[model samples]
Target: MQSWQKVQCGVLLSISIAVMAGCSASSPYRDRAEDYRHAEPSHYELPPIPGQRDQMPIPQGSTQGYTGDEFIAPRPESMQTGVAERPPVELRKDNQGPWLWVNTGPAKVWPALQRFAEEKNLDVVYTNPRSGELMVRADVGGTPAQRFSLRQGVGRQTSEVRIVSMSSGQALPFSEFDRERMMALEQYLLVTQQQQNGRVSLAAQNLDDGDQVRWVDRDGRRLLVLDFAFDRSWGELQNLLSNGFDEDAQRLDDQDRSQGIFYIHYLARAERDSGFWSWLFGSDNADKAKAYRLVLTPSGDMTELHVEDASGQPADIQVEQELLDWIRRQLT
Candidate 1:
């Protein structure tokens, strides 16, 4: 009995020790809860209600009454000065094409061209503003002749003056006189367009036409004009030539966009079919690839493209035309 009592006492002591250890472990959480419960409120204040004063006192003086009409501020001095300092309208000429483009519409250009004819002392044979056409007759070097056509260009806000010389009511081919007359008219109209200012007419802003490629004659040479920036035109030409040549036989040999030159390889079809061994062993009959150079020149807002052989000689007219036609189709 004595031994069992002793054992029971020992068990009770162990239980009390374990409970004390557990309480010590959980004391931190109880301390945290008590700290939160005793914390003071924050110091923030709510905003005052609109249209109701809480602290400010009313003024003692009499307030002014509102006028029936609202006060309107005057226009800024800068705006008035800007109107006086406005720059004159300037026209841009296409180097390859016989046309000029302006920001104003055809209505403005029509009157300007008419005024030009009057100033030149040319007889206005016919004038049609609706169709954007004008004809003027003048005597040049003792021969009575008429300018065949002076018309608005296909693009919006663009106009062209065709200087086709006519004698005895027959239209002649483009001549040196025609070229000089065209240049003179262009200069006169450019100056005239700059001086005039009025209400601009409403016309379709045909932005897409700015990118279309066209063929034009410049100094008796047929040149291809692309209405694109130089960088964009260069990239398009690279892709066009890359995909245009025979895939397996021909490839782009080299290109320099800054210099506006592209070198292309034209390998014979038979060379492509020959085995790798033939190429490695230097077969006597293996055909060599021919190289061609493409040159691009920027003319105002347009880029002109021309082709030549490896020897730096201009490509045959038919060859150049055919290549340009193919590129036009691809671009379209």
Candidate 2:
């Protein structure tokens, strides 16, 4: 029995040595916890320092904080009370029959033409806004294949649209077809103009008169001032004079844009004696249409429009004022 006890004690001692060896192999950082507990403290506590809670002083009349009723956001630099408005488009024809005019710029009209072409399913062959030209292939049902060319008007803010038919692969003047297309374009422009009339203002207003037209006194002569370029103003003036006056009573007989002169005829309102008896009586004293010249002179940014007699002399003050007033009334 004593021999058995000694053998058992040796086995127990070997087992204890094996277990300690296994634990030391698995836990290499076992001494780190003891080392940390025995280490000196690195950080020191700081004492509280007194300071003023309110360092910045508020202005005498200012509040310390925002009030509930105060407006927190800044005011806008500009206020938009309403959308600007533009005039309705007016379609007109010049003395030259082949060209038609629409009272809008090429920029606006070009897009509208594109939209029209798209709606009609016409294939656009070429389009150049810079050159103010468009060519399209019209192949609508029940109509022969055609090619159309649209050109912008001479003025910056106008369009002189034209169309041509394709015959034997060549372009030919399509007067009737051109008129039809022009009418259709006119309808589109009219609708768009009306729609945009409430949203955009195209004309620059004169601060002095609150109108697009103004008057200036230059070199002892009163001149009518138009807030448009020479080409546009000239076209608009021509349109106004042609349509605004009584039928056949007032007309522009001749014009030389290069020379800036328009020869106009204005007949008196009194009825002229006519027929065989009146012809036999010799109605030489009857009032006849007087010829006048409208001279456009560009001075810097604005164009000066002055009226003169056919002999190239300045019109009388009364005649000038009367014509100027009439034009102003018509334009405004």
lDDT of 2 by residue, 52-142 (tens): 3767878577332234564434223123211123244544544334444555555565666667778867777876555555566546553
Q: What is the lDDT of candidate 2?
A: 0.61
Which one is best on TM-score? 2
Give each model a TM-score. Answer: 0.33, 0.42
- Overall lDDT per candidate, in order of appearance: 0.58, 0.61
Which 10 residues in a row give candidate 1 its minimum summed lDDT? Answer: 78-87
Per-residue lDDT of 24-66 in model 1, one digit per residue for the tens?
8878655475687788888988898788865778868622221
